[model samples]
Target: MLRGAWLGLLLTLMATPAVATSMNAFRERAVTDPHGLIDAVRQQLDQAGIELPPARERELLWGMGTAAINSNDDAALAEATLRLDGLATVANDPVAAAAAGFLRARHDIANGVGDGLGEALKAADKVLGESDPEIVAWARFQLCDAYALDEKPAKALPLCRQAVTAYRALNDDYGIGDAENDVGIALATMDRVDDAAATYERSRQYFARAKAEQLVVMVGDNLAQMYLKQGRAREALALSRASLKQELATGRISDALNSSADIARAEAALGRHREAYEQMRKVVAQARTAGINGQLVDMLKVESRLAEQAGDLRQALADEREAARLGSAVDTPALRAIEVELEQRYAAREKELRISELEHANELKDLQLKAAEADAARRREQQQRQRLVNTTIALLAAALLLIVGLLALLLRAQRRHAAELQAQTLRDPLTGMANRRAFQQRATELLGSPREANAAPHVLLLIDIDHFKCINDSIGHLQGDRVLRLLTDYLRTAVYDCCFVARIGGEEFAVLCPQAGLAAGMRLAETLRAGVAALVLPQDLPVARLTISIGVAQFDGTRCHDLSSWMRAADLALYSAKSGGRDRVEASKLAG
Candidate 1:
């Protein structure tokens, strides 16, 4: 036995009751012999009988259930979880109940993957608020896992941080290290890889100091994997080899085989390809011997990659083919799904327990009179499970409805944002008027509008600011902008909203009048020409005056020419006006 107060005290319990003795042995095994504890507990449970099953299950579940959850072994957790739930029900021990509830929540998370996270959170909260400090610390550790499973790293990180404070308050190194390990998981999930690596290192130190070698191995694997990710392959290889050597010495074939793969990866990273190949070959051989198909398939893949790198094409191809054959032959998903379905319902159990108390209060009186306490407890357990199923169904339906509502809101907001963006795209930034694109679109809409044959004629006015370049050269573009704004003010006042005004290009504006003919068009053009001619400017302007040349073109629906040809005709007319004189309106002559 190790020279330690706790271990020595447990060593004194060798002649105690089987459950009592097994617990101390289990505690000792947890620190020193990770692989032996499960069988030890099972043997203890068998020897002790039904009366000792609850305590046996409770302690074993905490120690072993944790390893199962950590390893993501759904089968072990599912089996342990069922037995723990039974124990919690019959024993009515708060610590056992809390452990069962929290472990069940972990089972729920692992089973659903993500679907049962909300329920996991509720279960975690239930146990975290328990009166037992050790139980509370353990619940907090599992709560951290729940948040990670929830895919909310931000939420998980803060909870782990708070758990560290709580664990420190209890002065428990094991709890503190577990809390730190969770913090590393959260940090890794958030892609704070370097910080996660450092946190894992700190956690390993604590676990090692507390003489928890299993935890040290677990944390060592995590840190080594992180180091490999960061390309610190030499360090990762050294650390994994040391930890793996210890696992092998303890005869933990499973843990050793698992770590061997990681060490192989580290070797590959360090460019020791042949060494990596041999290490993974060892892993594949062990996996085959053990007949663990999941491990076999993964190890074979790793071996194949290593063999390929080592130029052993025949061996690589053989492993690859075998892996594929086994993978296809195995129908794992169906079995896994069945397990998941059984495992995912633990969250609502807490709610069911509370509700069952009130619903069976009167029944409890009759059961007491009949003196069937176990029967009453069994009845309550069954009722609680049934009610839990009902509540889970209702909650899932409400979640579906809420998701539909949120999706609808998201789509509505997306459409509104698109509309606002579209509007901004079509407007001129400087002039605060429609751009050419908006003008063309609106004109297309209006001309395509349904109208009688006798509908009023429409026209296009192409207006150019005359002597604008001289103004810019004399006073600068800033004053020219002021002059353009002034002229815009005049155009707005004269033609107003009835006509669409667009600044198509530099100092070139277009007006589209839908209800105006040649006569009305000429009048609007003359008004616009006279309005610009009468514009006043600041004394700082080079030329103290501004004017515009206008070209008015009437639509010939009979000819039905494109807008570009129409603009061409108006452009010719504008050239004629500039030749005729500045600040004048000209009409395009139609070809018969």
Candidate 2:
């Protein structure tokens, strides 16, 4: 029996290279024109005049199966998988039969849930019993994949680790790397984020050492996606862009689309809004053309957000509507029926689980309730004894109130008088504005401080009534006071939501404009300048016209230039304005 088996194996080994060459040729052709290659292979196999050995015939069927899978033509795959399965079964080749069965099972699962997962497991077990370590590792990987697809990654992870160990024992670096990549994905889904990233890096290093460019590209993309989830946008952006350029050069359109999507997200994070929008547009178009409903739905939603960032609300809404439409259209009648069946099964299972949990909870609650009842009986006796003491305490408190009432009134009057005296000191007395001390204190609180991301930068505007002494001497002091009040009204009105407005000194007012920066401050100063210039000061006031010189200072978003420094900058700029003949807006070097 051993001699016979050795002879059979010799013959099979001699025939293997020719069969493999044919399969490889067909695979290469299928990459560019899968349907044409499929049709040509089918025609050759169907020809009655052609005679081929069994091994070569099996190779043709396997090639056709792979091509069909690549084409996403389910019917063709079904036909090829069935023929390969029957031929391998009769040929008594466990390896060939296992591979054919596994492919068919994966195809079934890819389309929807199928009955062949058990069969796939059985085939994998047969392969595991074989002597080839590499083949056993591959079978273990397939088993891991089955568990992963069933949403049991924790079960799959041990198998994945075992596969990696087996591959390492055989010095199969490529196999080890691919298995580790699988392990990383499982870990990531298990929420071990740091472990997943480290595993991915290890896999990437192995692929790089092996000079497997395609595998390296795949690993790089996976790592970049992980970085995005970690909020490391800059790193993700760099890796994605580099990999995308390489993938595009290699004609990997699908991979390029995925990379482009990643690039969009990173660019948006980096504030390259328009570039991000363009990248997302290309991704949407490619996904739409590919007729990939899930990718299309995802890309459209991303595109909608990009549009919103670009301030194109109409386009954003339209994209959202289209995404919604596509999402609804993805649920075909068959898929909808399957979903409904799953939902029903889930509900029934959940109801049973809830009942079991509730029964357990009720037993615990009953024990606690019995304990509480004993405690409550003891508390009732204590409550009855405390009631008699409460009435005695209330009578004593009423008798003490009469003794303290007059003293409380006199103390309240003195406190009121002192509070009024303190208010009078902080007041400007003339224009009802905050005095200089109060102005400086309030300005220090609002300005000269770092602002939050959503908060406004602080701006300080210093106003000097141009030639105020002239106005006071030429017009009486009352008229000058009226002019100051007129300017005060403009300052309060303009700087209401602008934070603080005060008269820091006579004829010099300060307004702390929170959240306003250079351009905003300049515009405001120009407005206040224009507004005061345009003011008639009322025909009743002694002054015919009023003009003001102003200086503006704003925080540079770093160290808060203390209020004094900010004031000095504005004061210097104010001096420049005065020296340059007044009634103008000027920004300090710090402002620029």
Candidate 3:
């Protein structure tokens, strides 16, 4: 028997390279030509009397199964897994057997076959003591995925994290990305929103760096779903749209369907319920045609909600019923019986496992439980710290608001005080008329305006009280002030409403009429002179009458270009008026 075994081993070793080469070729072709590769693999499996090395055969079968899974060729995966199982049993190779079991478990989970979770647990047990680190990592990943699919996130998280550590240790970027994605899924399922978003980002970066476009899309889909749940519907919509585009470009119809469903959910959340219902209806049809029952049921349920929101109550009810029917159909008796049979087989094999192996597994479970407890305690502590921080922030915000309100009040008070000061600067103290500075500003603004064709020229008038020094010499200066005030009151009532009057100097006043020509200015100046002469002094005053002289100048654009030149012309006219006679009006020759 030993000699026969040695002879068989020698023959198998001789044929190993050719079989390995063929398997590598098949794997390479699987992406672009999956159906052809599947046919070739099937033919190779069926070929009789073509004995290959047991190890090489196991390697080929495992590669083929993995390729089929990646290509989504379920039929080919099932056949390859079945063949690998039979070969592993016949060859009595523990590592090969464990690898085969892991592949079968992964296949079942991917296809939503009978008792995927149970099969995964059995496969994990089979590979528990396996010396091969790669197979052990993969088994952990598969089991993690199974738990995630079953909605047991609490059970799934630790396993997924473990798989991440294993993949990191193996320096496998693709595996690390895949494991991290599962970790994100588990975290999202547990409602740890921030952690899940961070994990998904990490996974997406890893996949991007590894150039795994499909895996990146997978991570994006999960992240989009999380965003939607967080009420960030616009972000989810953008991500889902991008993912859908990539999935369609890559010919990943199933993934594209998922992305479309996510988009519909996001649209619904964004209050586009009618649009969401239309999109979800199409996704449901595609899912049904693709035979993706689990996703179809989810899509149908989403469609029902969207329909209800869209005011299509009848369609909503129909979709709800279909979803229920499909959900019930997913857990048939035949699938359950298959699951029971797998569990029984796993149980029978469990009894033959070594005591030390069982102890190691038990210890691992205990460590996991302890880790979970520690994590919970840490989370509670973090929550306390967060509450404290939030309280501090709230207090700080309130204080900031108080400071801002006080500052605003101070600013308003300063502005009001400044406005009073500005008014004081622009008014004469005694007369309450525009001062010299205010007169100059107003005249400059009037002169700066465009001169329209055939428009009336602006006029400036300067008036001076006559014999003001004699009045002060005869009476007291206080009485002279009273006389000056009496003249100011006469001027106020004498000027036209169009005139801008200002006390440009002591005992002197100027008026700027923006709509008046030289003739109007002379007329206004004469009126002021006559009005002051006609003013009656109070009974207490010694002076019997008050009088004034006036100067008039017109500011046509060609004659006076600016306020300075215009004032000079008006001052010259005032000098002529003063030289000619008191209580008289004079017009400048420079006037337009």
Residue-by-residue lDDT tens digits, candidate 1, 415-506: 57876888787987777778888888887887777654554577889999887888888779998888777777777777744578888878
Q: Which stretches of candidate 2 lie over 4 Å from their true place?
A: 1-83, 92-94, 104-131, 146-152, 245-253, 293-592
Shift of residue 379 alpha carbon in model 2, Å = 88
Error of 1 at 146 (Å): 5.6
Comparison by TM-score, 2 against 3, better one = 3
Clashes of each: 0, 2, 0
lDDT scores for all predictions? Answer: 0.66, 0.66, 0.69
Better of 2 and 3 by lDDT: 3
Over 4 Å off in model 3, which ranges? 1-51, 70-72, 94-113, 329-592
lDDT of 2 by residue, 11-128 (tens): 1111123224222234334333447767877887888334655556666666666556545566776887777677677777666676676666555433333433454565564554
Which regions in candidate 1 have their CA more than 4 angstroms from the true location? 1-28, 43-57, 64-80, 92-129, 146-155, 189-191, 213-218, 251-254, 284-308, 311-592
Clashes, model 3: 0
What order do you get sorting by TM-score, best first? 3, 1, 2
lDDT of 3 by residue, 344-415 (tens): 775565565656675686577557555655555555455556765877656655555565556556656765
